[model samples]
Target: MTYRLPSLNSLRAFEAAARHLSFKTAASELGVTAGAVSQQVKKLEGSLGVTLFRRLPNGLLLTPQGEAYLPPVTKVFEDLTEATEAIAPAINSRKFRVGMSRTVKQMLPANWPDHDVGLRNHIRDRIET
Candidate 1:
């Protein structure tokens, strides 16, 4: 059977909402309006054809479907983050120095011979030694 994935933004919203059990709090965390969070969650529900939350006067409650779905969703994000972090360059590595040098070259004036030569020599020295 084929399964269609919901929008990433919507899934993010739902994940945050599920974590907090509050759409308003989720919106605050996501830097969007509460209405936006609600809309995204609604869209996600529509896509999944499942009622994930039970809206109440005080706050939201997770449905059985939501309760069951939360762990896997959380795990997927956690796994993705762990995988990305595992493959990422070390913080103390020299990769960032080269990247910064490249950025400086891109932003500096092309006709300034002295500045350009000095910067190039500095970067080459760093790379060589």
Candidate 2:
């Protein structure tokens, strides 16, 4: 089944801003500039058709709709964190095995070029393209 959802970044901005009631604080926590957080929250508000925060000179205040919205959004993020943590150990324990063709293996370099700048440049050029 398909479901409509706003952008994850917007939801994250909304949640962070609502929690701290300050765009600057949310921006710090999210590793972005205050303007970026503000823009993200604005985008979220536009998508939801509601003003999520009442902007103030000093700080911010969540509107009634934002207050109601905060709990579910926060819960979803917490649940996602828990789910990731739960699966991390099993994920870490898994091993990957690569099988290559004999011809491809034969073509592989035996050792990295230690003193050959020309060979190094040639390999670098091939990888970059």
Candidate 3:
């Protein structure tokens, strides 16, 4: 069976709001307006067909469903960020040596010198593989 997911942006907004329990706080953290954050959260709630938050006079409160859902969502986002950073070139700047056969090394230019060769090669290798 295939499961459908909602928009990532909506999920992010909901996660932020759930963590803070305030639409205004979530908006501030996300750098968007409170209305936008509320709209995103609303969209997420609608997509999930569950009431995730209870609007209160003071602020917002997480419903039982939201409380139950928050940890997994937070973990998923954290894991995604960690995974992306793990493979990100900007994060992994250490030198990586590739042991190629003589024939493969011969295919590369011997005396070619470029200031951006490492960056270009890294990008090319990422795209190819």
Candidate 4:
């Protein structure tokens, strides 16, 4: 069956804006300008033919429709993140195997890479040659 849905970009804009209740904050999270987020949300509302947020002086308030829409949209984003991570092992582990010659290893400290906390997490294993 064919399903008619709004664009993913618009949905993401709406979801982020609704959650933060501020287009600026949402834009920061989305790595876009505030105007871009606002435009995308406007596009979403246009497609849905419903107003999701009420603009206020301080911030935003979710309309009743927005309150209802948020849960499923958030769930979709969560599910999508999980799905993508599952398919991409590098994204999940994001670690690498370290290989070094014996001379190079001897040049460094005994702990070597492990001495660095941030580096240790990314190094899954060390192989000496």
Give the alpha-carbon lDDT of every model: 0.84, 0.85, 0.84, 0.91
My TM-score estimates for the predictions, one after another, are 0.65, 0.68, 0.67, 0.72
Runs of candidate 1 exceeding 4 Å displacement: 1-3, 89-129
Clash counts per candidate, in order, are 0, 0, 0, 0
Q: Write the per-residue lDDT of candidate 3 for residues 62-129, one digit (tens) a residue.
A: 99999998999999999998998888947665555556666775687764223366756654232112
Error of 4 at 42 (Å): 0.7
All-Cα superposition RMSD per candidate: 10.9, 12.6, 13.2, 7.6
Choose the strongest candidate by lDDT. Answer: 4
lDDT at position 47, candidate 3: 90
1-129 in candidate 4: lDDT tens per residue? 997989999999999999999999999999999999999999999999999999999999999999999999999999999999889956877764556677877899778778999977777776654
**How far out, in Å, is residue 107 in model 4?**
31
Off by over 4 Å in 2: 89-129
Structure candidate 1, residue pairs in collision: none
lDDT of 2 at 117: 70
Task: Output the number of the TM-score-best candidate.
Answer: 4
Per-residue lDDT for 15-94 in model 2, tens only? 99999999999999999999999999999999999999999998999899999999999999999988987988565444
